[model samples]
Target: MVLFQEGLRIKMKDLQNTLEDYEQVKLSCDHTAEYIKVQSNNTEKQIKEDFEKLHQFLRDEEAARISALWKEEGQKSRMMKEKIEQMVREISSLSDSIRVVKEKMGADDVSLLQNYKSTLERAQCALQNPERVSGALINVAKHLGNLKFRVWEKM
Candidate 1:
């Protein structure tokens, strides 16, 4: 009966060691799970932050392009205005010359004919080649190709 008790003690100790090993494995598993959860959360936060930065970058780029477009439009408008003023001045000059010619109806035929020929030539030139003042065309799609590539690289 004492030998049986000694054998029982050895079995109990072995079971205890096995239980301790099992507890250690469970603890390690729990720690690994927690570590994975923290890493996952961190990765998600990093992705969100990157997306925010990318969105802001897009906004800034859009604003800059819009500003440039507006500036170009303003310049085009000013240039058109200047061209119109020049044309108006030219028309006024022609009108004044016509009035002078009418008043000098008794002037030499050669002088009047020469003046009319010069005026006709000027009018023809103006008609054939009009002043081309068009607004700037903002190409929004021009940057889209590079934009996709850049966004993909960020991802």
Candidate 2:
């Protein structure tokens, strides 16, 4: 009977210890869950911040590129316009020269002989042909080539 009582006491102590340990485990599990939640929130915020920074940089880069492209387009277009205007002026001058030659030809023989020297000089157009406008167009290749790779490399 005494040994039975002793054994019962030991079993009661063991149960108490187990219950305490179980409580400790539960507390630890709760702590772990809360820790994970906090960590996950922090990670999410950091990821968003990092992406926002990258996005802002890309936006600024895009704006700068578009501005540069527009500026180049304007400059090249202006250059072409000036070249065309110069060509028109040259054509007008050539037309006037032809009219003068025809007038001189229609003159009498005496007038023709007297003005022959000047007429001949005027007949020979001294105007040099306009130089070919090389690279007068906007260089799209330079802007678009490896664009993604360039942005990644910058990052």
Q: Which numbered prediction scores highest in lDDT against the true structure?
A: 2
List runs of model 2 lying over 4 Å from the truth. Answer: 99-119
TM-score of each: 0.57, 0.79
Q: How many backbone clashes does candidate 1 have?
A: 0
* Model 2 clash tally, residue pairs: 0
Decoy 1 TM-score against native: 0.57
Candidate 2 — which pairs collide?
none
Compared with the true structure, all predictions reach lDDT values of 0.74, 0.95
- Provide the lDDT at 35 for model 2: 100
lDDT of 2 by residue, 1-155 (tens): 99999999999999999999999999999999999999999999999999999999999889988998999999999999999999999999999999999999999999999999999999999899778999998899878889889888988
TM-score of 2: 0.79
